[model samples]
Structures are given as structure tokens and as C-alpha cells.
Target: MASLNILMAQINTLVGDFEGNTDKVVACVQRAVQSHPSPVVVFPELTLSGYPPEDLLLRPSIELRVAQSLARLCAELPAEAWAIVGYPRTRDDGLYNVAGVIHGGEIVAEYSKQSLPNYQVFDEKRYFKPGSLPCVIDIEGVQVGLSVCEDIWEPGPTLATARAGAQLLINLNSSPYHRGKRGERWQLVAARATEAGIPIVYVNQVGGQDELVFDGGSFAVTAGGDIAAAAPNFEEGDFWLQYDSDHAQAPFSGLQVYPPLEEIEAVWRALVLGVRDYVNKNRFQGVVLGLSGGVDSALTLAVAVDALGPERVEAVMMPFRYTSQMSVEDAAEQSDILGVSHKVISIEPIYEAFMASLEEEFAGTEVDTTEENLQARCRGVLLMSISNKKGYLVLTTGNKSEMAVGYSTLYGDMAGGFDVLKDVPKTLVFDLCRYRNTLGPCIPQRVIDRPPSAELAPDQKDEDSLPPYEVLDQILEMYIERDMSAEAIIATGMDRQQVQKVLRLVDINEYKRRQAPIGVRITKRGFGRDRRYPITSGWRIGD
Candidate 1:
């Protein structure tokens, strides 16, 4: 039986660092050659300049940098083994997302990505022209087909490659992380392999970009739709697979096949990776957040500590007149448990000063939400001051439920460089807190047991201003995520007035969401790139 060894390099890459990205590719190729004789190393799509370069592809110097990087790889990569590297190729018409096969210090064969994903955080059509032909290359007497990320998602490219007489398919990808995405990828690859009557090697990039985290769950599947080998997700490594040509069907074998993470754990890991990469890639000193001892802030602090470590995370409890002693104690307890540097800065003095200044102007008017918001603003000011002085990124703790209904204070609680739970709803906030505690008791039980509050007003509870989170989250899922109208939501057995009010809050809060910071997107429809709405729209529900 003739056997072949293939190496999948699942790596994390920084965007626009041409030299750095190329160096990583070359190093991985060298390692592959050293470990497996005559092995073919497959890298993720656009390995040269990183994936989703966005407008960086439009830069005048980007082409030159890509050319230089490719030249370096051709000259320095091992001569005995074949290397499949993804990059951008310029043509007379436009640029193409291409995967080139390099052997013996020269370009042998190349495949351009055909399917350009334009929706849901992808804008590939803006940059690359689609390729029409299939690319099949000979590797050690084995016919191997080449396809980029989106090509394998649809049937055209893989089917074309099969018709061209390829025995195996290699799909390079930079697919980002979302809940249950692994199962989807696995099923897609298995089905494609079966349709093409060939085995497949799916290699994906692993790492966190600005708001996206690619969990490298690279693997191989048989023509029979069976997983032959798999690698760990949210990790970087060179996974090897052995394919026996003699056994034509179900040939690939070897390597550990790690199970997919459960939903809560998967979401938790995504948040941690997203926070870690954003801080490290942007080169922040560390992170700081105002821990209000509520579930949202508690979870944010825990995520920060997990991502940046206790020494790097700073927690501050800004107490106002309405702040409960239990809130203060719970905040202190969690900080001590996490071993993060904790401080208590009373906002009373600042609030008093602001009220005194506004006394003359407020003489004829009654105090309202303005005063409540001022308390929050005072906390924001203190947190931002610490951020500016100490070089830490302020992590806002507002969850999606609050952000959806305009429950958050602008320039107050919403003032930060990043919001850890921006896409997470209040119900999930409690779930995540419990999940984190399962790993370890980092959050205080009292914090989770207590009813959620802003603590900005006397005995203020979140339910006092909005619907119950359990009900509100359901309404939000239907309206915001599922794109159901208010009428449709009311049809789901919810109160008509409640549904109307929640929908109105979401509609009116578009301006606030527009100004919110980018965070990790765990859902199919996130506020930033996924779900886009016009802030000035006069569109109304049930019109």
C-alpha cells in the first residue's frame, strides 16, 4: 500500500504583518519537512498577509509586500517537500484569493477561490475576482485537488475538481468561531467528500482577529463521511494525517480527534481568546473595569482575569449613595478570590460637586433619570481616568439585553475601549457566571444570587425599568436575531404591550448601539458587522 503524509499547519497570524506572516509559513514548512519525509504542508488561506486583510488589500504597497513575501517563501522553503500556501494574486483585471502549490523552489500549480462570501462579517467580493477553473496537482503520484475556504462550502468547485480526476481534496480556510460552527463544518466537509467520491483534508486558521476568533478545528474526513483525524480547536499545532492510496476508500488515519467544546465552554473560550488577542495585538498594557458586583461586571472581570491574568487586570468599585454594602462586599470578595488589584473609590464627593454646580439650573425642575445617569457617569469618569493614567483598556460590562433596550448610560457605563459582553444577553450573563464558577469560584455567590441592578438609584432593580430578562431575552431573540416583526413576536404568546415596548426600545436604541465598542460576536447576528441598521430610519413596527 502506498502511503502519503500530509501536515496541516494551524497558525495564528497578525493582519498586515507580511514579513512576520511569511516567516511563520516558512518555519512551519521547514518543521513539516523535518518531521515527515516528502510531506505536503497545507496552510490556512491568505497565510502571507493574514486573513480578512479588509481594506489593507486595497493599499498601494500591499501587492509589493505580498510579492516580496512569496519570493522569500520560494527561496527559503524546503526543496524536497510540496507547500500549499494561500495569498492574494494580482491580475490585469483585479486581485484573487489564491492558493499556490510550490515545489523545488518554483510555483507549480495554483487555485483561485471561487465562492466569495459577502454576507455576515465577510466582504470578499469587494476585493477579489472569482476564479472559474479547477486546480488539480500531482503530489507523489497522488492527484490532489486544491480549494480555498468558501469553495468547499458550495458544490461547484469540489465537484469540478472531482470531475477533473482528483483523488483527494485539500480545502484551506480562515473560518471564524461561532457557537456550533464546528459541527457545521464537519458535516459540510463530509458531505462534500462523499459527493466528490474522495477524501478531504480541511485545514483552518486558529486565532482571534479584531472581533472574530478562528477556532482551528482542522480535520480529515473519508469519502464515507467518517472523520479520520482531527486537531484541537482554539490552538496552534502541526497536525499530521496518513493516507493509504492502496486502500482507495477511508484511507486517511492517525492523530487525535478532540471533541467539540460544549456551547457554554465554547462561547467562554471565544470571549477569552477575543479579549486576549485584541489586547496583545493592539499592545495594551492591561485591562481595567468598574466591577459593580452584578452578574455582568462579575463575568467581565472573570473573563479579563482569565485572558490577561490577575496581575494585568485591575478592578475598581465606584460606590455612590445608592450603592449597597453587599454590592461593595461582593465586589471585594470576588477581587480577592481572583487576586486582582482591587480598590474602592467613592463617587459621593464627585456627585455632590456636580449637584452643587447644577443647583441653580435645576431650581425649577425636578430630578429624574438625569441624576441617576450622573452617578453612572461619575463611575465612568473614574474608570476612564485610571485607564488613561495607567495605560489599561477599560472593559465595559454591559450585556446585550441592556444594550438592546437603551438601558445602558451613554458616556457613562458605555464608555470603554471594549465591551466583553456586548453580544451576550442578561440570561446568558448569569449562565456564564455559573459556568465560570464550575471551573473555579471566582465570582461571589451573593453576586449571582442577588437580583441585577444598576445601583445608580435607591433600590433600583433592572426589572423596575425593563421586562424580566427571561422574557426580554426571548423577545430579543425573535426580534433582533430571528428578524421577526412585533406582530410575529406577539403571535408567540407574549403580551402585546410588552412586545411592542421591547421592540420600540430596540428600535430607538440604534443610535446607542451605533456608538458602542466592538466585542466578540458569538451569535449569527451581532450588532457590529453582522446586524447593521440605519440609526436615522423612520421605519416603525406594524406599520
Candidate 2:
């Protein structure tokens, strides 16, 4: 009848907010103790400092802050419970990402993360000195092993811990979200559990941090690679699982694993969570995005309202000569439906004024993208003004497709503090718009049905300048995300001309993307921190 209660502390943490994050830890431990006796509570990696603390780890105060917080936890926590939480441990050699076990108001055991992920949005190697040993401690007559985020990804630490006489294993994580990542985690963890023959419990952080969003799809798996329990994705809460020695074959019992989020649904939640945390964490009063009648803006507006609510979101429609009457109507309609504050400020006068002022400088240049860019700049100015005055964040609506090919104008449409769809491609933007419609009446149906245009030029269709989004997005995914070369992509049956054009655009547009705002990253490689390319490069567009 020997059994243990495990509480998964899937909580959101603000990076560098030691006091606040510690408060959450203390509260969670207290809450778990009240309900379950001698509960084994596990928190995500870097629980006190938050994940990807980035350069904040370099500051001298990091050691002080972590020590203070750890001391507070030891003093405040109940003596009976065993709480395993992640924090950066400083040693004479260097700093290490360690999961420390707190029992009876003191850290009884510690295990530093062995695998420091350095690629693609992670730079842990720059900060942490990897640990070589596995830590297994006795908890309530049961032996448990400990590891941090990246340790579970590799076989070394898991196998090493299992060999150390551990009957159970606990891994902490601050794993970020990308489409299809959850499935990858499930498969990988199941393999580890089956190989080690030790039932494992995984806990992950939930919430957004800058371009990164932790989905928190924590779970437990049996030694035979079967799922025993799972926490929901893109949420923050404490979920419990029971481990009984008597039922070794199916020891986990308190919670059952449910179906994970579908890919599209998970992406939508990632966007919402990313936007919400970016705004709230930065302490912005609210968010204001340009609600052009275009699909991109329409989708961005819907996400904003859903993330921050109608009261905290404001939509401004700035129209130019090319801006259609239908565009105006649809923007107003959606805004009305969403109950967000909507304002229409015609940019015609602003455009005219800019043109008039630049008349002398633009002596004999034939009209081109410059004029179209001026229109976008006009709207950018209006939005930035509102943002500045009202203390609201200006959310740009440029999609990844436009961002990939430099279709946006710098200091024009790209002028903003944040871009919600910065990582979402145009094709997916429409899908999300349609998806939002399915949830409720937020985006207008016509907005989803209509052809996407910048409305910068009369009779402008995005396809007129660039290829159709369906083709463009596919190529972009191959080139940017998959890192496929133009020839490789063309050999895969894509049109050579379109592939060349897209690759060329993507390569040359690094300057523009460098200046673009940070947004949610839902793909394996987003334009932000996920994909890093130099603005200045002599590299050609070939393999």
C-alpha cells in the first residue's frame, strides 16, 4: 500500500522576477500540502529566475537573488513535504542549472542539468557548466531520480539515473512551443521510460516569454512507454498523480492522460498566450493594432481581443486613397462585434502632407513602391501616436510571408513594438482567422473570404507582386524553416522561378527582418530568435 502523491507545478513565471516567482512556488507548495500529505511537488526548470533568463544570468546579483529566494522557501515551506524545483546553482567552477529538492525547509538533494541546449532559441551553454553526475534521493521510503529540462532529451542522464537505483524519475522543464512539439516530447519520453524501465514524471512551465511560449504539456509515463497522466497544454495549474509501489505496472493513478491539443488549436493558443504574456509581463496598459481590413490585420485584431479582452484592446483603422470602402466597413463590423474600441482615422491628409513636403526632394522620380510605402508610413505614424499617448503597445500585423520577402516597409507597417503574426505565415493567418470565426463571431467572414491586400495601391492584390500565399508559404517553410536550398526546393517539384524569387527575397530581406518586432514562434524556425541570419552576407542563394 506504499504510495506517493506527485503535484505537477505547471505555473507561469516572469523572467528575473525572483520574489514573484518564489511567491508562486511557496503558494503552490502550501496549497499542495493542505490537500495531500507529504506530496512530491515538482516545478519547471529555473522556477525562481524563469526560463531563458538570458543575460540576466550573467549579473552578479543573480547568485544573491537565487540565494535569498531559496532561503525564503526553506524558511516558509512545511517540513513534511518534498518539493523539487529548478534554480541556477552557482559554484566555484561556474553556474549550473540545477533541480534542488527541498525537504523539511532545506535543500536535501540537487542535480545539475547535463545537456545544455545551444541551438535554436536556446543558449544555455553560454551560461551553464554541465553536470556529469546523476542525483537520486530517497523520498518517503521510495527512491527518486532528478534531472532538468535538456537532460530528458538525451539518453545519458536518464539511463545513468535509472542505473543509480531509482525506482521513479522526475524531470523539470521550461520547454518552448512549436507545432508538433508535443508529439515529439511524448514519443521521446516514452522511449526514455521504456529504456530505463523506470516510471517518469515530467513537469513543464506554461506561459509566454518574449518570442517563446511554454505549452506546459507535462505528463507521466510508465516503464513500458505508456502514458499515465498528462497536464493540459498552454495552461497554468497544479495537477496531481499518485504513484503506488503495489501497482508497479500501472503505478500512476490520480490523473489520466487526455488527448493533447490538435496542431492548429495549439498554435492558436500559443499565439494568444504569447500576446497576453508579452503585454502583461511588460506591464503595458493595453494593446493597439492597426485594424486594416486585410486578413492579416483582421486576424491580429481577433487575437489581440482574445488575449487582452475587448476592454484592453483598441483597433484603429487608418485609411488611405487605396483603402476600400468595404475595408472600412468590415473593420468597423469586426470591431463592433468584438466590442473593442474602434477608430477610423483617414491617412489621406497625412499622405498628402508627406507628399507635399517631399515634392522638392522627389524632383523627377517615377512613382513606385516609395509612394505605397508612404501610405503605410502614414498609418504607422497614427498607430505609434496612439500607442505613445495612451501607453498602449502598437501591434503590427505583418505576417511571416510578408516578413520573409520584405514586403513590409520599415518605419511604415513594420513600425511597432510587437507583431502578433510575426512568426505566422499568411496561409496560416487565414486558417487562424477561420479558426477564430469557429470559436465565435470575432473576425468578419468576408475578411476570411476576401483576397489579402496591403491596400497601398489601387487594384492591389498581394499575388500581383509576389506569388500566391499557398505557394509562397510552402517555399518559405522549406527555405527558412527546413533550411532547404533553392535547388533542393526546386528539385522537389516546386516551380524554379518562384523558388528562386522566394529564396532571393528571403536572403536579401535579412535587414528588414532584423528590424522587425518580436512575435510568437509557433514553427520549428521562426524569423525571430529561432532563425538567425546576418543582415550583411556575401553568401549566394544556392546550396
Candidate 3:
């Protein structure tokens, strides 16, 4: 039996760092050659320019840099093995997302991606022209097919390669992580393999970009739609598989399959990776957040410490007139337990100064939510000032439910460099808190048990203005994610008036969400890129 060794190099790449990305590829290739003789190395899509370079692809200098990087790879790549890598290619027609095969220190074959995903966080159509044909290459007398990330999702590319007499398929990817996305990928790849009647090797990139985190759960499936091997998610490494050609009927064997992560663990790891990469890549000294001993802030603090450690995290408790004694005590306790730098700052003086300055403008009007919002703005100003002075990124703790109903005050509680829970719902917030406690008691028991509140007004609670989170989250998931109308939501045994009110809040809050900081996206439709609605639209639910 002739055995073929294949290496899947799942790497973390920085956007537009051509030299650095190339260096990583060269180093991996050298290591692969030293460890395994005559192996075919596969890397993720656009490994050179990183995934979704956004408008960086439009720059002219990017083309030159890519060319230079490819040249360097050709010179430095080990000649003992074959390598498959992804990058952007410039042709007379237009630019394309391409995968190239390298052997004997030269480019051997190239495959342009046929499917261009333009929805959600992807804008590939804005940059590249799609290819119409499939690419098949011959490696040591074995026929192999090539596909990019989106190519296998559709039917044509993989089928075309199969019809072209390929024995195996290698798909390179930069697919991002969302809840249950790993299972979806496996099912899709399994179907593709079965339809093509050939085994597949799927390699994906792993790391965090601005708002996207690629969980490298790379794997392979046999032609019979059985998973042959699987790599761990949220990790970076080289996963190996051996294909025995001598057993022509059953070439895939001796697979190493890693277990899948549960929903809570997967979401937690994604948040940690996203926060860590954003801070490290942007070169922030550390992170700081206003802790109110609430579930939201507590979860944000825990995520920050886990991402960068306690030494890099600072917790500030800003107390106003409405602040509860329990909140103060709990915040201090959590800080002590986590060993983070904890400080207590009173916002009363700042609020007083602001009210005095606005007395003349507010002479005829009684106090309303304006005063409540002022308290939040005072804390926002303090946090931002600290961030500016100490090079710390302020982590805002607003959840999806508040952001949906405009419960968050823009430039007040919404002010920060990054939001750790922007896409997380309120119910999920409680669940994640409980999950964190299972690891250890990082969050206070009282905080988790107590009712949620903003503490900006006297005896304020979240439910006083909005519906219960359990009800609110359901309506939101239906309307925002599933695109159910207000009438449709009401049909599910919800009150018509309540449904209308929730929908209206979401519609009016578009402007606020437009200015909100980018956060980790854990769902199919996040506010930033996935769900884009016009702020000034006249379209209403029943219209």
C-alpha cells in the first residue's frame, strides 16, 4: 500500500501583513518537510492577505506586496514536498481569490474560487471576479482537485472537479465561528464528498479578526460521508492525515478525531479569542471596564481576564446616588478574587457639575430619562478618560437585548472601544454567567440571583421599561434573526401591543446600533454587518 502524508496548516494571520504571513508559511513548510517526508501541505484561503481584508484589497500596493510575498515563498519553500496556499490573484479581467500549488520551488497549478459569498460579514463580490471552471492537479501520479471555502458550499465546483477525474479534493477555508457552525460545516462537507464520490480534506484558518473569529475545526471525510479525522476548535496547529493509495477502495484510515465543544464552551472560547486578538493585534496595553456587579459587566470582566490575564485587567466601580450597596460589595469581591486592579470612583461630583452646567437649558423642564442618562454618561466619560491616559481599551457590557430595544444610552453605557457581548442576548448572559461559575466562582452568587437594573434612577429595574428578558429574547430572535413580522410574533400567543412596541423599539434604535463598537458575532445575523437596516426608513411592521 502506497501511503500519502498530508499536512493541514491552520494559521492565524494579520491583515495586510504580507511579509509576516509569508514567513509563517515558509516556517510551516520547513517544519512539515522535516517531520514528514513528501507531504502535501494545505493552508487556509487567502493565507497571504488574511481573510476579508476589506478595503485593503482595493489598494494598489497590496498587489505588489502579494507578488513579492509569493516570490519569497517560492524561494524559501522546501523542495521536498508539495504545498497548496491561498492568495489574491490579479488578472487582465479582474482580481480573483486564488489557490496555488507549489512544488520544486515553482508555481505548478492555480485554482480560482468559483463561489463568492457576499452576505453577512463577507463582501467577496465587492472585490473579486468569480471563476467558472474547476482546477485539477496531478501530484505524484495521484489526481487531486482544488476548491476554496465557498466553492464546496455550492454544487457546481465540486461536481465539476469530480467529473474531471479527480480522486481526492482539498478545500481551503477562512470560515468564521458561530454557534453550531462546526456541525453545519461537517454536514456540508460530508454531502460534498458523497456527491463527488471522493474523500475530502478541509482546512480552515483559526484566529480572530476585528469582529470575526475563525475556529479551526479542520477535518476530513471519506467518500462514504464518514468523518475520517477532526482537529480541535479555537486552536492553531498542524493536523496530519495519512491516505493509503494501495487500498484504492478505502484510501482514508488511521484518523485522529477531536471531540466537539458544547454551546456554552464554544461561545466562551470565541469571546476570549476575539478579545485577546483585538487587544494584542491593536497593541492595547490592557483593558478596563466599569463593573456594576451586574451579570453583563461581570461576564465582560471575566472574559477580559481570561483573554489577557488579571494583570492586564482593571475594574472600576463608579457609584452614583442610585447605586446599591450590594453592587458595590459584589464588584469589590469579584475584583479581589480575580486579583485585578480595583478602584472605586464616585460619579456624584461629575453628575452635579453637568446638571449645574445645564440648569439654564433645563429651567422649564422637569427631570426625566435625561437625568438617568446623565449618570451613565458620567461613567462613560470616566472610563474613556482612563482609557486615554493609560492605553486601556474600555470594554462595554451591553447585551443584544438592551441594544435591540434602545435600552442602552448612546455615548453613555454604549461608549467603549469594543463590546464583548454585543451579539449575546440577556437570557444567554445569565446562562454564560452560570457556566463561568462552574469553572470557578468568578461571579458573585448575589449578582446572578438579583434582578438586573441600570441603577441610574431610584428603584430602577430593566423590566420596568422593557418586557421580561425571557419574553423579550424570544420576540427578538423571531423578528431580528428569523425575520418574523410583528403580526407573526403576536400569532405565537404574544400580546399584539407588546409585539408592536418591541418591534418599534428595534426600528428606532438603528441609529444607536450604527454607532456602537464592533463585538464578537456569535449568530448568523449580528447588528454590524449581518443585519443592516436603514436608520431613516419609513417601512413599519404591518405596512
Candidate 4:
């Protein structure tokens, strides 16, 4: 049996950054050639322009630039080495998410994606034409089967490739990270490799792209359904594997390693990377947010400081007349500890102006929730004003639990360039605050212990407007994520009236979510793309 050395460079690449992505691929190939005896190196799917170009793939100019970039990458390839990369291939049928195998400055083999995932943060079918055949290439007396990301998730694609006389399967993946995805990926792909009796290598992309964070838990499994070698998740590195015919497959030793089982820390890291990359890739100077001395803004600021450094992150304390002195002190202390630039811009005068403007219609109301909402909008206007003046992107600090229950004010706190915790729930928000403190008390301890409040009105607590987060998050998980009916939610030993009330708020808040900016996702069901509900939905009834 012959031996083959394969190098998988799980490098971080940005979306739509053609020059950067191309340069990355070229550098990786050079490193691969110098470091290992492998003649072939594999990259994550869409390595030339990053994964899920979204609607950017639709632009003809982008496609042309991608093609030119690929040509440039080919021009720099060494004579003895082969590069297998993923890119977009255009044809009469439309565009295809393709994998190109380039050897000697020419594309030797190209395979289009067979299964385009359209569910759960994916819209590939809308943009890509499916490929019907398998692509195989021979290198160093070894037959390599080629398939894209989703193709490996399904069984038939892998089997079809193996049956077409391929000895080894190499899958290029840009699989996004969700909770417990690595275990699931290993289970399915290992099962597929066992069934087909072929060794499988999975390479995933690393780094953050908008709401999506691709954890490069790339790995290789043997034909007997055992993990062989794996890469580290949430980081970038070059992973190598040596395969020999006579050696028995050791029981899958180096399968991917996750964070120290600290799930909230993982969430925090993902958020930091997401914010850092999104801002850095989009060419923003820095980040600005309305710091109301709440856990949500506090956590967002911590994440921003860790992600882009405190030098690039700015926090503005937008205090209203009702904003408490404790809120101010806690926020200021947090800013001081995090060592980021801080500013105090009171929104009381602006809030008074809005109330005066609406004095005619709100005369009989005697200053209600409308007044609270006005304070938020005033803060929003001020944050945006600063954003426009300094060219810094405003980061909204609303969490998923608030957004889910419509407890947030639209065109107000929901207004920002990017939302850091839009997909994180209230429970997770508390957990993250606790986690941040464990890392040497970055967040003020009082900020984590104090009851959550919007502080838009005097003596206002989150419970005043909504149910307890413990009960509320449970009810929400059942109804929103699990698709439980209101009756079903009540069956879980929850109060019927509370269930009905929470359901109503979630139903009415669809319009607010529709108007919200895109936020970092950390849950199974998030507001942005994963969870879709109609604004006109009337699917609930009073319990």
C-alpha cells in the first residue's frame, strides 16, 4: 500500500475580500509545500472569497473578480504541488458552489455542490445550481473523492463518490458553528465513512462572518468509524495527517478539542470574534454603543474590548432623567475597568423635547410607557449622531430574551449598525456576566448581582414588564424554539396567565424584530435568519 501526506490549512478568510482571500491561499500553499511532503493541500469551501457570499455572489463583478483571483492563485502554484480549493463556477444553469482542483496552473477537476442547504442560516439553493455527478482526482497513486460541505452531511453524496472508484474522500466544508455541532458532525461523517469503507477528511473554515462563526473543527476519520486526527476549534492552524497502508487505524486519537466545557465562555469568544471580524472586514473604524449600566450593554462592552481592544471600542452612557445613580456608577466603573474610552452624554434634554413635541396627544396619558420609549429613541438618535460624526458603527445591546418578548423599543434601543447579543437569551446573558467576572472581574460584580432594568422609567424592573427570566426563558424555549403551542407550554407546569401574556408579547413583537439590525447569533433559534415568524401572524389565543 502506498502512503500519502495530506495538509489541511484551516485558515481564516473574509467574505468578499478577494485580494485578501487570494493572498491567504497563496501563502498557505507556500507553507504547505515547505512544511510537508504532501503534494496536495485542501482548503475550506469557498476559500477564495470566504463562505456564503450571500447576495454578493449574485454580482457579476464579484464573480469576475473571483475568477481573476483564482487565476492569480494558480499563477503562484508550485510545479510539484496540487491545490484543492472551493470557489464559485458560473455556467448556463446559473452559478454553482464549486471545488476546483488546480495542478500545474490549470484546474484539473471541478465539482459542483450536489445538496444546497436552504434551512437554518442557509440560502444556498436560491443562488446555486446543484451538481449531479461526482468528481474524482488521482494524486500520488491515491484516488481522492471530492464533495462540498452539505454533500457530506447527506449519505448519498458520499456513497456515490465512493462507488465511483475512489479510495479516499476529501470534503471541503465551511460549516458554521452551533452548540454541539462538532459531536454531531463526527457522528454522521464517521458513520458514512464506516458504511462506505473509505477514509474521510473534513476541512472547515475558521473565523467569523456577520452572524455566523465557522468553528474549524476539521477532522479525519478512518474506514472503521474511528476518529483519527482533528484540528482545534475556534482557531486557525495547519493540520497534517500521514496515511500508510500497513498501519492499523488507531482508535481516532486527535478528534477536535472544544473549549474547557465552559459554554458561556465559548459564547463570549464567538461574540467577540463575530464583532471583531464584522467590523474589521467591513472597514469600520471602531464601535460605539449606548451604555445604560445594564448587563446587556455591560456584556457587549466587555466583548467589544476583548474583541477589538479597548482602544477601538467606545462606550457612551446615555442617562435619562429616570436613570439611577447606581446605573451610572456601575457603568462608569465597568468602563474604567475595561479601560475603553468612555463618554457621558445625558439624554434628558432630548427626551424632554420629544415629550414636548407629543404633548398634545399624550396630555391625558400622564407620562406612561410612551415616555420610557421616548428616552430610548433619544439615546438612539444621539448614538447614531456620534456614529455618523466619527464613522464608528453603533452596536445595539439588546439580548434575544428581550427581543423575543417584544420588551425592546424599535427604532430606539434596537437601532444600531450591529447587535452583539441579539441571539443570546437573558439566562445566557446572566451566565456570560458571571463568566466574564471569573476571568478576573472584568464586569462589575454589582452589575451581575443587580436586577436587570431598562432604566427608562423610575423604579422599573424587567419583571415589571415581563415574567421572571427563569420562567420566561423556559416558556420561550418551548414556544419559540420547540414550536410548542400555548397549551403545551402551560402543560410544562407554568402559569397559564403568564404563558398567555408572554405569548401575546412575542406575537406583537414581530414588527420590532423585523426592524431590528442583524445581531450575533448564539442560540438554536435566533431573530435574524434562523427563526422566521410573520409580523401578521395570528397563531395564538388567550389561555
lDDT of 1 by residue, 1-543 (tens): 567789999999999998999899888989888888998999999998898899999998888998899889889988988999999999888999999999899899999999999999999999999999999988998999999999999998999999998888999999998878999999999999888888889999988898888999999988888988899988898889888877766688778678988999999999999999999998999999998888899999999999999999999999877888998899999999999999999999998999999999889888799999898899899999999999999999999899899998999999999998988989999999999999988998989999998987788899998999999999999998889988889898999999989999999889999998889888888788888888888796523
Report the lDDT of model 4 for residue 505: 83
lDDT of 4: 0.84
Tens digits of per-residue lDDT, candidate 2, 1-543, equal 668999999999999999999999999999999999999999999999998899999999999999999999999998898989899999999999999999997999999899999999999989999999999999998899998888999999999999999999999999999999999999999999999999999999999999999999899999999998998998899899999877888999988786888788999999999999999999999999888888988888888988999999999988877889999999999999999999988988888899999999998889999999888888888989999999999999998999999999999999999899998998898888888888988887888888878888889999998999999999999988898888889998999988988888888989999999999999999987788877778986643
Q: Is candidate 3 or candidate 4 better by lDDT?
A: 3
TM-score of each: 0.98, 0.99, 0.98, 0.95
Which digits, one per residue and each the tens of the lDDT, describe model 4 over residues 1-543?
A: 666677777989988888888898888888888976655788999988788788988887976887798789778987667788999888886898999988888888999999999997999988889999998888777788999999987889999999998778899999887766777889999999988888888999988888888878788888888877888777788877766545546423323443333566668778887888889988899999988888999999988988899899899998777788988998899999988888999887787777788788777766567777788888889999989999899999988888888888888998898999888888988898888888876888888889998887678788987889999999888887788889988887999999999988888878888898887776667777887777775565433
Against the reference, the lDDT scores of all candidates come to 0.91, 0.92, 0.92, 0.84
The true-versus-predicted C-alpha distance at residue 63 of model 3, in Å, is: 1.4
lDDT of 3 by residue, 1-543 (tens): 356788899899998888889999999999999988988999999999998798999998878988999898888898878989999999999999999999998999999999999888899999999998888988876889999999989988999999998888999999999999999999999999998888889999999998899999999888888888998999999888888766655677655788889999999999999999999999999999999989899999999999999999999999988999999999999999899999999999999999999999999998899999999999999999999999999999999999888899889989999999999999999999999999997999999999999998888899999999999999999998899988788899998887889999999889999999999999888889898888888887532
Please rank every candidate by TM-score, starting with the best.
2, 3, 1, 4
- Model 3, residue pairs in steric clash: none
- Predicted structure 4: clash tally: 1
Candidate 3 residue spans exceeding 4 A from truth: 248-250
Backbone atom clashes (below 3 Å) for every candidate: 0, 0, 0, 1
- Candidate 1 lands at a TM-score of 0.98
lDDT of 3 at 390: 99
